[model samples]
Target chain A: MRVDVRALGACNRLAERGAERAADALADLTGTDLAVEVTGASVASGEDLAEAFAGRESIGVSVGLDGGLDGEAVLAFDSQQADALLSLLPGGASMGRSAVTEVGNIALGGFLDGWANYLGQAIDMTPPRYFEADGAAVLPDGALAGDGVFLFESRLDATTTDLDFSIYMLPDSGPFRDLVVGKTATAATPGAEGAAEGTGDAGSTVVPYESLSTFASLAKRGSTNAADNIGMMTGLDTTVEVSRLRFVPLADVPAEVGVEPHAGTVFELQGEPSGYLAILFEEESAAAVAASMLPTEPDDPLGDMAENALCELGNVMTSGFIDGWANVLGTSIAHSPPEFVHDIGSATISPIVAELGRRQDYGFVIDAAIQTEGVQAQCDVYALPDERELAAALSRLSET
Target chain B: MSHPSSAGGRDASGSARRVAVGVGDLAVVDGDAALTTSGLGSCVAVALVDPTTGARGLLHAMLPSADDSQSSRPSARPAKYVDSGVDALIDELGAAGASPNRLEARLVGGAEMLDLTAAVGPRNVERAERALADAGIPIVARDVGDGVGRTVRYRPNGELAVRAADGFERTL
Candidate 1:
């Protein structure tokens, strides 16, 4: 089914509004100041979603939904913040998991209320189920089994206290598709713009929902190609850990990539789907990966020789990345020579995102994580494709 | 992974209240409180401080101007754009009992970080400077136009500390 860009933007905005409302509810209940720091609608495979929260220890509540929406929603708290969150409850720190569950229930209710109001139908929710484990375990079973799932994720922060939480909504494909399909159909009807009126520019392309999954697979292949190139260059066993497409607000792009210091190379892709690409590694990983490239370990991992080696690796990987997209779309894609950068993760991406933010409020970030088996070496490859051009390319692929 | 502590409530003097200003957001505080924002690349952090009144406002803006944005209407988050964000910061400090004429601006961030791209960093810095100039607000100090990301912390006492990712720290 085709989904109009306008409809998706509207849904994204609603998700933000709903998360804000949820934060308000939590604030009201706990008597603490809270805010929604970031919100975005994303398309990712189960493995990608799992990988996102796999390492961190978290506690959360999951609930099933029906009526206006059919899906499962998970509200997770960083376990370290659990004490702060628990302290806000009337029962105080002694309440523990039950209080956490109640907070989740109220926040999810407030969250779904916006969607329900928009759909003009009540969304019934099942009782909250509490889960405490590593990040991925918070998600219900079978959530990690899908090829692609539409997810609305938001991060909430508390101002007065050191508390924060994340809400992840996994909507069932059939019902979610129907929702988008219906909204887009209405958006296309003359004089019935409704929800889609204020969101999109005129003449936006409509992309088939399934095509997003195809693009995800395309990203996976590209990342796999990159991993193979890394293996060939470093002679280390490297593999693609996760690959997914995330649609996020332009302003949040930097924070999404993260704030930690990173060593990377940046390139600009020039072609049918011209955009920017960044291949980043944590400091230690960068050192390890760079050292593996040279005959002997470099005296300084970020010195001239290591920087050149990393740039060369980034060049081949950039080729491996866009080459998949180029082959599949039957178009030629060229990339600028790499620009070596070793700085805060967000700093490396904000300029690119800011440039894109001038014309588009949202960005399609194709993210991939590559890991070397025997060392503390990991790489994060981000490919931000020109949204309109990518939509056009994907639509053409669907047509074929 | 754990979040980077936006909580910088402790200093040499004593314990102070801390507020974090996230991306495309702003915050204003008075008295023994500090305002902080981090991970600023091309995004500019504009701080308005009234040393006389001990009131301060911080804006973390991503884009130069909302006028240049695709949307024609004013954004709900006015602080997301520098021109409007500076205006909002001035107005907020005014509400906090700091006279608009008494406010002096100190800027941080606006780094290009990566080379040969659209010059959003320079544009953001220029836009902020113009906005402060237009409002008859003088810019007291600034640390900008570099290839680095910064985390900034401002206290009402007129101390604006900026720490670059490369372990360089400066008080503007």
Candidate 2:
């Protein structure tokens, strides 16, 4: 099944609209002005999702949907904000979890209206389930560990108060897959027609949504290869810690990489889906890793010999990284000679972002973190592919 | 005095309230608060200050022009491009009780941190300069166009500090 390139974007709009209505409903219930800060749909592993909420304590309510769409929705606020919201209710501090649950039920009603309206059907929702615990525990037990799921997340902030809320929608795999792959069917569903009309761009390429997951797995394989190459060259035990795909605005790339000084190598990929790849290491980690590859300890860890050693390592890792995609595409992918760079983390990234920004607004960043066991060495790998080309390549995958 | 406003956070160097401008974002502040942004490479951060009213605005722009990028989204951020970002900063500072005639621009960032074929740092700097000149704002101070990333802190009192990754710090 082929999916329109605009399918994901249309889904993002639906998520944003739902969040906006939910914010309004919450405002009316609590008389506190609220604004939808940001909303998007991302594909990530349950482990990564759980890791995102590891530290914060949150309170909110969750509900399951049965009709029109099959999935679960969660509305939560930080513990401090929950306390402030509790004081706003009629029962004040006495209402506690029930008050939050009631608000969740109402706000969720507003959230589902967008999806139901678009689907041209009625959706049934289960009773609200109140939760007060660590943010990770709030998700359903099945969503805490293994497979990747398509998640819609929206954040809302109160304009006049220091409170914020996050809404997470986890649609069951079947419905979510059908939503994106709808266009390929001879008979288009109401939801698919709406998505096509919402984008107003029909000439673009379409690929099966399932191919996205396939590509994500390809990223996981690339990281594993890089880890093996690191272990071989440095004689250090290396493991792939985090591997995930992030879809974000090209403009946000620099800030997301952050402000720390880094030492690394950059390469430009040349193939079906031409793109860029960067292997960045913390300053100290770069020094240590570079030294490990050399027979003798160099006077300056980052000197010419160390730089050359690092470059060779990056060369082999780059080949190992893109080899998977090449095999999947049935075409060879070549990369430029590694360019050694030492600068602030974001600085090394923004140049590539600007280059990609010339033709694309959003990027699918395949990122992975590799760490040396019992050592301070950590390497961050980022691969950004041209969206149009990627869609074309993935469409070929569905054909095969 | 610690006002503890929701819009501000603890400054990295002191107790003063600070608003951080992210990539392709902008902020305007009143009174004695600080506006800061970090890890600027090819992106340019422009600060427009009106010393008379102590009102200031900062813009962190990633590209030279909006035409250079393909953004199909409806809410294309104005601060993502140098020309539009400068215009937005000027309008915001004006709304914050700062007179347009008295605005002075201080520029930081725009570094070619990597030797890529299509260098954008110089183009971003050039565009920012032209944008400010067209807005009739004087270029009072600037730290631009090098091979290093920089962090910037701008105060309403016309103090701008630039810190590079190589331990170089200067006040403009």
Candidate 3:
């Protein structure tokens, strides 16, 4: 089914219902919900919600929620976890595609299916897509409106591993529902004023999920999170899938100009003159990736194909990370293109090397290991921080 | 199993032990040989240890070389910037006759924070590589670059185990 105007209206009401249902579901899933005192919860980032999966890696059945906002869901499982989750299935990764997609299809199906049955509203859902990483840059645009976005999140500890999902909804305030239900009295005359009145506050226009509690006046639960309804949890929501976006371009460089002094460059944090840092993969991995890419190896090559792939892979992932940071924080930043290096001799590295070695100023560091179809990539991210935001990230649990 | 810490013994004759330091800011000692440094990322860390005395040191760098010179002690600040940090390390080790020939090294970090068209992570990592190559020390082991931030540790005696995105740590 597709999302139509009437269907959109129904989806909106169902999403409203979800808010109320989410709070209760969370209280039940967390077991410690009574201790889970709802903080003011004025704001939360997609990253904060995503990071919830750190260290707890055996998560299968990835789920993505692309509703009325630019938010996503990611659930990854290790190979063993994937195998067990897809028990009695066919062969390897390829054979498991349908089985994995089924997980998301079922999870989403449960939500919409239950909503349609309970509210008797005609809400439709799109087929779930597989996500390797949290696609912050590719999130549906123009999905949100107004100010005061609210972010609500909950975690569930299932039989073996844990499961979690965040529902990001925007409150498009209007008097339509009230007018339709209240003014449509028997023998009552129609009034244009009643229908035209609007909650025109700019904040009221684009309410974020985190700020939903503030908009409790307008926003309500959209669908009930199937916490108490464990019977409905029969839907699938676990699997591991991988997608690699590689740019294959064949370019030749002069043999004389072989040294690419600036081949692998990454992150550019903002400071006075300039501030930046990048890690260069040792020569072996560069050679490994090159061996996989090239048919023949030449002496003193212009640039190793493996190094190029490795660096560019870093570039894409880091670029995507920057975009994710900007989108979630609703901020903007500039960065340099990535460069690669081979046979870079070892040297002692110091923290002060980047920030000029002063503890007075320190940046946040993120170390992650990324595994694609045939490549293993490692990268780090740093973001300078101060008070409020710092506290939040330190408090973030942001991957799932 | 982890390597045994043989960084015992104090200042010795010309015989200095080999050391590969990890991520962190502290001096490591293995007999008389000593190296000091930090890893790089959007955040930087340095490692330092002595081979003759089995001492080492490191510091992870974050900002550029200039910011570190903001107000730190002239000598104390050199080991902070990539350019001067290496110089300071060499000079400090030189006090014990640690020559370029006897000195062997390994480095890590300098992962970027943002990946704009002209980010700084690559630049910093590049400069560190260039500076070290010019200094004549072959990099024994390193897990650095565009991918992920690493918490690299150094072993002054054997090889430093690098634990990061990849589960198994390797000695470099």
Considering every candidate listed, which one attains the maximal TM-score? 1
What are the per-model numbers of colliding residue pairs? 0, 1, 167
Which digits, one per residue and each the tens of the lDDT, describe model 3 over residues A326-360?
Answer: 44443453456664432221221222233333422
Which is better, 2 or 3, measured by lDDT?
A: 2
True contacts kept of each: 0.70, 0.60, 0.13
Query: lDDT of model 3 at residue B7?
Result: 29
Off by more than 4 A, model 1: A6-10, A16-40, A45-60, A76-104, A114-121, A130-147, A155-166, A181-202, A365-367, B1-14, B70-76
Error of 1 at B133 (Å): 1.8
Model 1 lDDT tens row, B67-120: 888754345667878998898888777878999878888988888877757788
Candidate 2 on A135-239: residue-level lDDT in tens?
A: 678765456555567777788888767888888888887776686566333323343322533243433546666676666566666767767877887777876
How does each model score on lDDT?
0.79, 0.76, 0.36
Chain B of candidate 1 versus the native chain B: what TM-score? 0.90
Q: lDDT, candidate 3, residue A128?
A: 60
Question: Candidate 2, A8: how far from true, in Å?
Answer: 3.7
Give candidate 2's error at residue A211 in angstroms.
1.4
* Regions of model 2 farther than 4 Å from truth: A4-41, A44-62, A65-70, A74-148, A152-168, A173-202, A231-238, A301-305, A371-376, B1-7, B12-16, B70-75
